[model samples]
Target: MAKRDIPEINAGSMADIAFLLLIFFLVTTTMDKDQAYIRNIPKKVEIKTEIIEVEQRNVLAIKANNQNQLMVRGEIIADPDKISEKIIEFYNTNRNVNDLTNDFPTYTHPTKNEIEANLKAAEKELESFEEQDAGDALIDYAYSKIDEWDKMKRSLKLFGGNDFPLINSQANIRIEVQTRTQYSLFAKIQTEIEEAIFELRDTEAKRIFGESYGVIKTRYISDEEPIDKGKLDLLDVLYPARIIEVTPKN
Candidate 1:
């Protein structure tokens, strides 16, 4: 019988071949997904139409006086609970706004000056409206807006002279959702505030102030009906819990 020879494999370059194959796979492999919050961004000023891109959010804050009258966003909320519902729905306390801006849609203009002018005008108009309705049952609510604006400036301010956050993303955690959703949330908040104010007013109105204009107004302090801080705290906790995002689904 012919001698059977066993074939020997090359071992000298095996390590190098294995290393090359590992490198090749590593370069071609996809990385694991980064866990991050998603967002929907809006366009910039130039291409933005008359219904301009208003990056905004729904936020609520409650402030009440000794009268047990709740104020949301500044206006007296007659129903603290209702106002809370609206706020809770819109409030993302930890929302990272800087990221939101970076992902926002861009609107290009023929010239930088044009976009600047438009942005300025829009800002002015928004401010004017804010001032006009400043105290319209929403004095306490000012804190949230100022906080938001500060967040906006600090986040967009970094992008040259844009009046937003200092970051390039122009991302705001403010949660700029659909107009209808925004309006609906605001309305709920507003209604709650109004209800709180109404209750306070009713308490006062029920009591007759002195005939003279300068006399002090008073409520009949009854032991059973006496208001307490705990009451307010409880109300605050309970009301905001009911907030729901109400938008029609297709």
Candidate 2:
């Protein structure tokens, strides 16, 4: 019966302790994940207020509706796998100067088989030279041979008429999606289109340097890391993902 003199427990610092714990967890936990796509954000530049016209024929228009239905130009595309191939066709179409596309595979070693054959031959020659003790001459020659082939395949600047065999280097691809379209669907379509461009460039890379497109990419691979810059530069020239996404419109 001595419960009458019990001391009251202090609750003043409980909230403060909880607040400290919350702050500790907040600071420790990493919430943001890495972004899937390599976003090439443009810098804000004040340009001359001049209206420059772009021809309709030069633009490869793609549209994704609310239902996730994909359309290239006016034609509807049912399968997502075929989207990239279609993009390639649209990009390479050359009816006239206004409607010209990247006309790869001329007299140069553009084909995968062609490039592969050349590389294999060079590699074999390099091996033979090594056996015969050609010293720095053979090593330098082999490296230069591969380097030249890689450069030919991957280019930084787009080929104009005066340059290599490539057409104009202007931005030609445009993607538009409806407002109500699911982001997932839009992302998938956009990825496929990029894959198509990547496929072309990758194929060229595989032939020239015997490596996949991802391995040689500057974004994924670092400059500090030992990567063939020649190959990366060539890939950029061959397949520049210059797609312009407009505000989602119905």
Candidate 3:
């Protein structure tokens, strides 16, 4: 019997081929980005300030329960898509004229003269605080008041009208969710709120600046232009998203 010789298989290029395939996949494959909602966490208060009561008309309450059911302003919403419409209505209902009979937030139209007078007063208070060497807390409070008045002045200038309309200071959108509520529903609520606010601001931006809110925001982010920043500030002042998220209770 003749013994057969076994041939050796060559694997010298196997590593190189695998490396090439890895590189190809790495270069050609696309990854999905994680979506997230960015929100500012309120600063912790060291002092116990007096709690001011918010009127029912000024609060837009959105609630979600363990069953994922949604309720807005005491009305149950079957379709999540309608949430945005409700939000839009809440803002637009009393935007131009106030009707005390209606259960919606009221608008305040502050004239330029009024804004200027308040700004001057704020400046004087700030100066007095500085001269008196007031504590940091009081001085900071004065500075904040001055900043608020200055912001109002800029907002009024950009508004380009006899008066700048502002929503009630106490107006806010509050979101309350149960501990077992689905994250998807919570995210949907946030999305609806964001969509409603964006639509309002975009409409106003187009009317005032002849540009879209998204475009102005993108440009401001990229270039940091003062004009675009002012436009954004005015738009924000017109449709501020004062949102409060309540902690889910067990």
Local distance difference test scores for all models: 0.39, 0.66, 0.92
The residue-by-residue lDDT of candidate 1 on 1-250, one tens digit each, is 9998999987999999999999999999878976532223332334333753534322233443434454544565575466534443333232234233332323221233444554565566557767788654344345444544433333232223433111212212222224334444444444654454334333333342212111212221223233322232222221222223323332
Q: Give the winner by TM-score.
A: 3
Which has the better TM-score: candidate 1, or candidate 2?
A: 2
- TM-score of predicted structure 1: 0.20
Task: List the candidates ranked by TM-score, beginning with the highest.
Answer: 3, 2, 1
lDDT of 2 by residue, 32-96 (tens): 98767665655444544577676565567788888889887677888877778877775455412
TM-score of each: 0.20, 0.55, 0.85
Off by over 4 Å in 1: 29-32, 38-250
Candidate 2's error at 217, in angstroms?
A: 3.3
Candidate 2: what lDDT?
Answer: 0.66
